[model samples]
Target: MELISDDAPKSLELENISRRFGNTYAVRELSLSIAPGEVICLVGHSGCGKTSLLRIIAGIDTADRGVIRIRGEYVAGPSRFVEPEMRNIGFVFQDYALFPHLTVEQNVLFGLRNLPRQDARTKAMAMIARVGLTHLTSRHPHMLSGGEQQRVALARALAPGTDILLMDEPFSNLDRGLREQMRDDTLSLLRSMGTTVVMVTHDPEEALSAGDRVVLMRAGEIVQQGSGYELFHSPNSRYAADFFTAFNKVQGIYRNGQIHTPIGAFPSARQLREESQAVAYIRPSDITVTTAQSGLSGRIVQRVLLGEIEQLAVKLDGLEEPICVRSLDHRPPDTGEVGISIRSEAVLTFPNP
Candidate 1:
């Protein structure tokens, strides 16, 4: 697949959007644009407004203030609101939202009730085949696997000929292995159709691997938005860094262009203001453990063997806290005496309050 450029404009635009629930703000003055054919995943903890924003876009909920435009035509604003059915948008709910009493074909054709009987049957059958459910069209929702039921919901949503798709944790109900397979398959189908999608998920790995762009939300506001690689390597805030990956933090002080921490004195990346306190963050992969006498001293406290890597907890001299380090090769060290070293380039410092 060719790389997608940043300048493309097949986009969903939201400007100055806000939603409130009486005294509490659900979404606070948010603004963003998702490109055409782009799978933009909204990620945050529960009650962080990610779902609320998606609901607003789907016309299921009204925004307190803002303008929403799809392909440059205004669809939502303070004085104007489009009904959910007229928005020409498809929605896949978290629970699969299939009617238990209806057959697969009937469920798929449910949205086409107003159309002529022959036309609705033709469209529903075509969608069933498109979703690889033609063989099970006569069966009810309970007769299918979790993944199959999810496809039925997807086909039903796509039957309406909508280019925009909104999904809310569509795979949460599936088992782990099935969830991964469904995610890949769903993404492939949507991309093949050039469908623009906005999905809400709290999983970081899912957001990183499945989205063309990832938006990280916290407490009703967008904290960071960027491509997966960019956000992983260059997070602008501690929350983003901690949320996306594991990091070990150490308190230290900067003096004379170097930081003095429990580990040791290390050169700073940039000149620091005089006598400033700071927090240094380093990923578990960045620390190296060795028996060499030249490195900082620490004691191995615990060792946990994960499939691909082993996590070690170490208590260092002069540092009261324990730090975690991950290694692909596991070499058990003595619990009370093991030396560890910090890589100079992997250290990230933040201003201390």
Candidate 2:
């Protein structure tokens, strides 16, 4: 891939943007900035407005309020609006969206309409080669595998002189193996070309590993935006914590800046009023499992087989729900539980909801 221009600036800026339908807000007062050539991933569950925000940025959907700027130029707002086709933005859909009747080469050529026919063909074939699809350029979408069709879709999107690219769950449809391969390929390709990209995905792991920055959205609003490490380790809200990592919630009465639970006593923030109910969010990875039988007694009621880690459910003497622990310690499939140890630093305490 060749550079579009060293001086090209295609940074995106969204200022207090909002879009609503009837009483529901699809995108709330959201503001974000993306530097040129940065890849950002928007993540949340369904109805979180990630796709809505992506469409608004691509000019496929208009925001009801606030400004949308591309390279410091106002594209959508009260006074100005740019149509989708004129924005020089490329979009790759989750389904690949390749025309079944068109060959891979023709599908890529479709994006280079502004150029002469010969120029379009040259660029189209170049893009196909860039995506490693030169050998299958004549194949139709229906004849290609899931990953191949996706590459064709990607080539088509990038074939034009697009400044920014948007992808919505681009690899969600592929199997696990194919998804991982495509992810590495896509990121490598984008970095080589320095393409500015904003992708929306529901997969938390993908958002964590793929993007330069991850933006977590909830209820049409951005909950947090930062590096994956920042969001995972320093989440500001309980919702944010629960979204990024699975936690075993335990309820306790907060007093004197600490909460006692069935597992153990963990410190709470001073702001938590004494004697008030609090909940401790403990990550499964932090919980230690032992066969000592001397600590907090529990029995393994269920065991889940994950490739690298064993997820075990322990039923405490008095607690109703089993505490979950993910451990690398090898255990027999039918082994009984013994002891539980909770790591203090991994525990997050919040007011009971």
Candidate 3:
């Protein structure tokens, strides 16, 4: 991948940006900046204000507070508000939102109207070929598959050579296999062209895979923002931890800066008064089912076969709920005592909220 030079100008910036509905703030005091060729993904569960923030940045919705700048120039703020069409930004909608009446080539040509007729036609054909849809150039939206329509929408958004691209669940409409393929293709083209991107996806895995930095949001606020590995391995809160991956939770009493769980005592990040409650969240992938005889023992109660791995439900000596563990073996252990070894780095301890 071609890296944008450090000297490349700031592509997009938002200062204390916010937007409000009738009685609620969709986006509250959000601030972010994008480099010339950076890709940032805003992700969270539904109604986390990610898409609302995206709309605010794209000028489709006005901000109730704060300033927006593009390439060091003020665009939206208290004193200035740029219209959507005036911002040199491209938007790819969730459904692609192509013109039903227009052919693939015509839909792409629609965005290049600023150029001359011949130039627009030339650019449209080039974009059509670029996305590998040259054979479907004359197909209408209804005649094309969901993935084909998405390529058309992408071509239309990018044909005009915008400085920034904003995608809202660009591959959500495609099937699983096609989604992965399209994502790789889209990122490759964007990285190659050095266009700045801020994409919104509700899928946690998608955000982790596609973004250079992942920003997880919750109720109009940023829960955490960092590289995929950083957020996945060292999340700041229980909510952030649970959002990224499934966890087996255990409650323990806080004492001497430690939380004692069923498995063992674990260190806590924050100091809590003695006798207070603390919680330990452990991911299933971090627990290894072993033959070693010295660790915590549990009886395998249930096993589920998932194509690449088997999910096991183990009942510990005194815990009420069975602890879930994932194994790559084709079959789970025979219904018998199984020793469990938990990785220290995979356990997250927090004082109870």
Best candidate per TM-score, number? 3
Whole-model Cα lDDT of every candidate shown, in order: 0.88, 0.88, 0.88
Per-residue C-alpha lDDT of model 1 across residues 1-353, encoded as one tens digit per residue:
23555476756899989999998889999998877788999998899999999999999999999999887778899778889898888999999899999999999999999899999999999989988999999999999999999999999999988889999999989999999999999999999999999999999999999988899999789999888887787787778888899888888898887777877776766566768997787899989887747577877888898978999998887777789989887775457676677887767766675
TM-score of each: 0.92, 0.93, 0.95
Of the two candidates 1 and 2, the one with more favorable TM-score, higher being better, is 2
Q: Look at candidate 1 and give me any clashing residue pairs.
A: 10-36
Judged by TM-score relative to the true structure, which candidate is superior, 1 or 3? 3
What value does the lDDT take at residue 307 in candidate 2?
Answer: 90
Task: Mark the regions of model 2 whose C-alpha exceeds 4 Å error after superposition.
Answer: 1-10, 334-337
Give the distance in Å from residue 76's predicted Cα in candidate 1 to where it truly belongs. Answer: 1.0
Candidate 3 lDDT over 1-353, as tens digits, reads 23445466689988898878888878889888788888999999999899999888899988999999998889999899989888989999998889999999889999998899999999889888989999998889999888889889989999987869999999998899999998999899989989899999999999999999899999878889888888988898888888899999999988887888766887777677898988888888888888638578888999998888889998887689999999886553478887888886567888787
> What count of clashes does model 2 give?
1
TM-score of 1: 0.92
